[model samples]
Target: MTSLQVKDLDSGYGRIQILSGVSLEAKAGAVTCVFGPNGCGKSTLLRAIAGAVDTWSGSVRLGDQDLTGLPSHRVLQHGVTLMPQGGGVFPGLSTKENLLMGVYLLHDRAQRRHAVEQQLENFPRLRERLSTKAGQLSGGEQMMLSIARSLMLNPKFILFDEPSAGLSPKLVSEALQRVSTLAKQGVGVLMVEQNIQQALQVADYIHILANGTNRFSGTPAEIPSQKDFMQLYLGVKDSFNQDKELHHG
Candidate 1:
């Protein structure tokens, strides 16, 4: 089982940098989570690893393979996949059709069919919605479909961006549970999620970002308390806000 590793990564859009010497490790059979204030570059870290964003410096590695600077498709070819924000499902496609599309790269008809059937077995909730359009499914259902589809490629690692974003609290719990299940099944999961408590419960390792760099990294139990984290990050934000207000005044 290979682990996804990012070492001193620096990347951003255009001339602006969102990550600065950021590094972390996501291991197979574990869920590694990135938590940060908005604009702190949690998503950029995942994008950088997947080669969806350019790495201005540093390295991305999966075992001995150097993945730095590889294009997104090439990254996928190497057994790493990403589930974009909000599941990235084709709203117009049927649930089954969307799952089938996940393995479109496999030219063998039998292989593709077998892959879809395997996902159906793992995600029985999707079995009932095979004929429904993806957009018509509930938020939780769509997330399940996305997870099932990603596994079709048999990726060693998967990146998730805001898996619980649009779901209700109950749905969010269910979705996070599903993420944990993926880890139990031996898939390395790196996720960006806003549901702090839920993520803390399920994540094997937690990394918190601030100003495009890691502010904290540890197991949930290592924290003094969630309140301490809130104060640490929010306090920085509050100081910045006061300075801004003073300048405006």
Candidate 2:
């Protein structure tokens, strides 16, 4: 099965350590959500998997290939892509132009054209604003463009860093739905998100990271049973109780 696996990973910036012995697996046809409070090294973990940060020790493997230590471009060629937070798009470029940049690795003109067409189909909203500058789009639209750009490559696994950040409640729901659809389409999705309720709704499995290491990992169904876990690691009252109050009140 296609999967992204990280084993005992330790990585950080120069002289400072952020992630320590962190490990998780993102499987094909499943959405894995990483939850953490601020500064818990969630983004750092994704960056380490994307090969944007240095790994002091550990292995990142996709299927049978060892991806550790490879540069970002090399990692992309291996069917892994990272859609960073804050809608990483060239503001001055048109929506179509920004998507075309995603398939730069495709040398053949016909193939590149086909990739863009497929993305346009997947994101019909972008088709209407194909010529609009990315900066001119709304926050939700920009997020769609960022995700559509990544989909242009048709990667086997996607590392999304806070896809719902800064979006309105309506847009957040839509964004999470799109992510869930990607996993159904057989793309392994590893997302770091602070939207706890939304993340639980769509995630097949959840991993809670604290102090740069995994503190809890379980299926969504199991989360409600762990009240102390929710209180201690997540720093919240019982999630189940909260849900119950919201429903009954």
Candidate 3:
């Protein structure tokens, strides 16, 4: 089943068009990775769907609800959460405090407390850092905190923008594993990433964007098997140019 869908989406800042006629869909219990080089509009597509930027055209729907042009908070309330690239945790707050903040929408204090316990159970590292300030944690720990905070919403669909950014190789592996766990638990995930190799490894489907538009998209196995995959985003031309210059020298 399709958990999220965007059709003919055109969005950008002011008059600058970043995504033109872009379309994609994420299935329930699956991870769809959007891979691209810098300036390819990967992050813009995510912001547009998250309602951070206004959609100039096309439609976005989460499950059966139409989300086009909705406010970010309203869209969030509809069970579509966008987790952008960064350590979104509050540095000044204690680890437990940050997790509790995630459930502020839940008015009942008792419920929020229970939710904190549940989050701790899911993130053992968080349990150890409950009293520590978020700023004191390592990059991987911060990333885990950000993810655990999002899960507090118990969302139906999540848009993750480079969740593996600024992490060690081992952390990247763990982060991707966590994403896979989210998928298996039936949460729909759409991830935008620059960690192409690792992202492709976890992705059920891969969408490659170039110069503000989708250039190629297919299952990981299908696209990586072709030259276009590397040429499209990996700067194959630059590599070849460097090699040629060296050979001539």
Give the whole-model CA lDDT for all candidates, comma-separated: 0.85, 0.86, 0.82
Each prediction's TM-score versus the true structure: 0.91, 0.91, 0.90
Where is model 3 poorest over a 10-residue stretch in terms of lDDT? 240-249
- For model 1, name the residue pairs that clash: none
Question: How displaced is residue 68 in candidate 3, in Å?
Answer: 0.8
lDDT of 3 by residue, 1-249 (tens): 656888889999988999988878788799989887888898899889989999999999986899999998888888888887885788999999999877877899888888888888998989999999999999988998999998887888889999988889999999998998999999999998888778777888767776676565567765434465767565454321212211100
All-Cα superposition RMSD per candidate:
6.5, 5.8, 7.0
Clash totals for all candidate models: 0, 0, 0
Task: Report lDDT (Cα) of residue 242, candidate 3.
Answer: 18
What's model 3's TM-score? 0.90
Off by over 4 Å in 1: 231-249
Clashing pairs in 3: none
The digit string of per-residue lDDT tens for model 2 on 129-210 reads 9999999999888999999999888999999999999999999999999999999999999999988888888999877777
From the highest lDDT down, the ranking of the candidates is: 2, 1, 3
